[model samples]
Target: MAKRSIYARELVNLMAGHWVARAVYAAARLGVADLLEAGPQHVEVLAKKANAHEGALYRLLRALASVGVFTETEPNTFSMTPKAELLCSDHPNSLRPLVLLWNELEYSAWDDIVHSIKTGECAFEYRTGSPFFDVLEKDMESARIFREAMAGASRLIPLAISEVYDFSGCNTIVDVGGSHGNLVSTILSTHPDLKGVIFDLPNVVESVKNKMGDEASRCEFAGGDFFESVPGGGDLYILSRIIHDWDDEHSIKILKNCRNAMGSDGKLLLVEIIIDTNNESSFGNWLDLHMLVMQGGSERTEAEYRRLLDAAGFELTRIIPTGQWQNIIEAVPASI
Candidate 1:
């Protein structure tokens, strides 16, 4: 039987997301999941292969095993569980990038969560002494991880958005700040008639083009800062999880740029989590905090979205809930 003290201690232990982060990071850094793809091995063998200390690596594996990340076949041998396989870098739905990004950039920023709570300022800027995007632009490795994380997110979002929104009417779709063209690829794959353009910074565009290959041939790549201008002439403009990266003033400028580029008949879709006003349970609430701690942007409620749209000379037409946390907010150019 479980002891009372054991129950209390386990409850406290369950709340530490850091353990999961560290374990995942270790698996990523050591390529443990990749090694296990060939199958399981003894702790001594695995540790030597990964260049880790046997006893310490065993302890880490034991901790992860309890959470079902890996399975202990016997006393000192281990095998990959289903959960562990997701960490494999070559897995189509791999979470390696997500784990790495959180551990590297997000984790460091979170060290100053107290400052963010107190001053409502981004801990990222406070810690790094530069804006998040500026730092990303300067650092190549971090930028690659960021792009991969964004692409992973895009894969999930495409499944959600395709189900709720009809892209049948769209001839040309522009994915603003689209990283690696994942969203556009998903869209084009589903709707063959649609053509696309990926708009992002020049460095990002270069990276995306290299990754996209054949898809790059079909979709145009335009390198320009969204703060300055966006490529014109797409009937449907999609800003997927883009606005939340900036303050209200900057977000409005991006929306206004889309407004100017869009024709009267064109549609503007902002794919994002609409924060609930009633302070209820929400994924966006947690994400809002992360944005604050990491980037200084806050998620917005539907009313806040409406206000931003109005300021940008667009009328909020409809809010289509995707059942998932994200919603498709459709807007149109307002009459001057």
Candidate 2:
């Protein structure tokens, strides 16, 4: 009975887990890890550099150190740990942008999760009185941060996709909605003979032109809406994290567009989280809630994916699990 009581208490603590998330967000926002990049610093020194209250900074550092984000060398001095290093923007696999994105704006949207549950609408739009992307479009800083957050969160998944998936024997691989062209760049680097196309909106393709650099030489930047049409003649089309943002009807439209664009022997790859059955502990389950709150989309099961692909005039061939958060759902045109 005592152990049962302890377990129940632990569950309650987990329910309030966002407190620590907000604390870490505050640390990332203030660039605490970056400040410690030079060396260990006293809390007062960090507070001065970050323009925060010294005592409050010390308290924050103490709590974070308890969680292994940093190490307290002395009464007020703190040093970065490997975990804290991830919050530094200079780190190669830094999650700084994602942490920053989870700050006040995300919190405000999440606070209205109840409203989303009640109305089957976006909690963000309900709270902010506008769509999340519309607000992002108006605010350049917010838009930049959101993009960086997405890229940062995609860190290992692109490399994992490039490495695990066989891209051989394909003339052209079209990355639909390939923002920043990271995945295609990784793929092109591995498959030398494969020409790649980054297909997205005009502004999206333009924004990442300079970012593509040498990859731009071997890749074509085609600007258009995937729902309307995609560039033709590509044997393989990669739709990474694109379909989950929409409802079933809209998802079908985008998939149908891919089907229309793909030739008889062409393939369509969807990279998304595949929710498992009766698994309350799966990350995808919680992410499904996040999706429900942020938009009306939800993480899908393998069967659900098959139904969607069939409805979009495609046949689901296989589902490959990647080393990252996503699973690759491969399909071909039904006629094939």
Candidate 3:
């Protein structure tokens, strides 16, 4: 066999990943994984169920099968792979929403990446004439998908948090900017003795309340704005994946709210991805760019977190790794 050139092969593989992502996105949109859940199905049946063209659907399935997302069990028939299982909408760890969400949010924004890089402005905003979050607000469909996508992606984080952190001695946990109370619910479920407050916009508060059900017995839904103020009298405050959505000024403002809401000896725990200084292939590295393009925010290094927390009237205590994508950042009021 003729030896292939390693350099060209690697570069083409990199380019092929772009095609694979698009193929995966199409599969997700067409509900392919869910359709294949029972057993293997021929393209003719899948296309009809999915309201897609049979020939095109077959080609898409073939491409995905080559990459292990699905398997071409026999000619014209396909079955799900472990990778494809993540696309099943009913799966607890489903990434289908994320794929759909990327199609709505990131895919087009990524097309005009040059503009964001050139002007230091959000590509989503520049292209759509609205900020990323604003788009979520105006477009009801976008908002729902965004919520589901984030909730699905962070589903395990709550379990990780409950397991890794010691909740002893803390009576109340305030999940600032927490949506649907999943994290708060997990903590409250773990530490039955502790009470929880779900703080967010009025609409989100209602959603959280609706979702909490029996858990509401030990939880309070505080419907308000974090930019102005937060609910007080909490033993500990949790700001999970919140600070990274804003620039330093807004981040500090939210941190200060937590600081003000804190009692003496109160601690702040922020769930975020801690970025390292050195260059490496990391999710944080990819997210840093996503933050840059969608919002003017960036993932922070330890030094950056320390500085941000210090300016917000707290001292960075330590960072706890959950052996997952996110780490727990602990801080305390400086005076204490």
User: Which tens-of-lDDT digit does each residue in 127-147 have in candidate 2?
Assistant: 888876567657767767777
Clash numbers, per candidate: 0, 0, 0
TM-score per candidate, chains pooled: 0.90, 0.95, 0.95
Cα error, residue 145 of model 1, in Å, equals: 1.2
For lDDT, candidate 1 versus 3, the one ahead is: 3
Question: What's the residue-level lDDT of 170 in candidate 3?
Answer: 94
Model 2 off-target regions past 4 Å?
Answer: none
Looking at candidate 1, the ten consecutive residues that score lowest on lDDT are 209-218
Clashes of 2: 0
What would the TM-score be for candidate 3 when compared with the true structure? Answer: 0.95
In candidate 2, position 88 carries an lDDT of: 96
| lDDT (Cα) of model 1 | 0.87
Writing each residue's lDDT as its tens digit, candidate 1 over 1-336 gives 569989888887867867776887887778888888898889999999999999999998998899898999999899999989988888887888888898877788998999989998899999989989888888989999998887765567877776678887789999999877888887777777889999998888988887774455569999999988989989999998988877788899999899878888899999999998889987799889888898898899999999999999999999998776788999989877
Question: Residue-wise lDDT of candidate 3 within 70-163, one digit each (tens)?
Answer: 9998999999899999999999988999899887676888877799789877777788788777676566677778778888889999999999
- Pairs that clash in candidate 1: none
RMSD of 2: 1.7
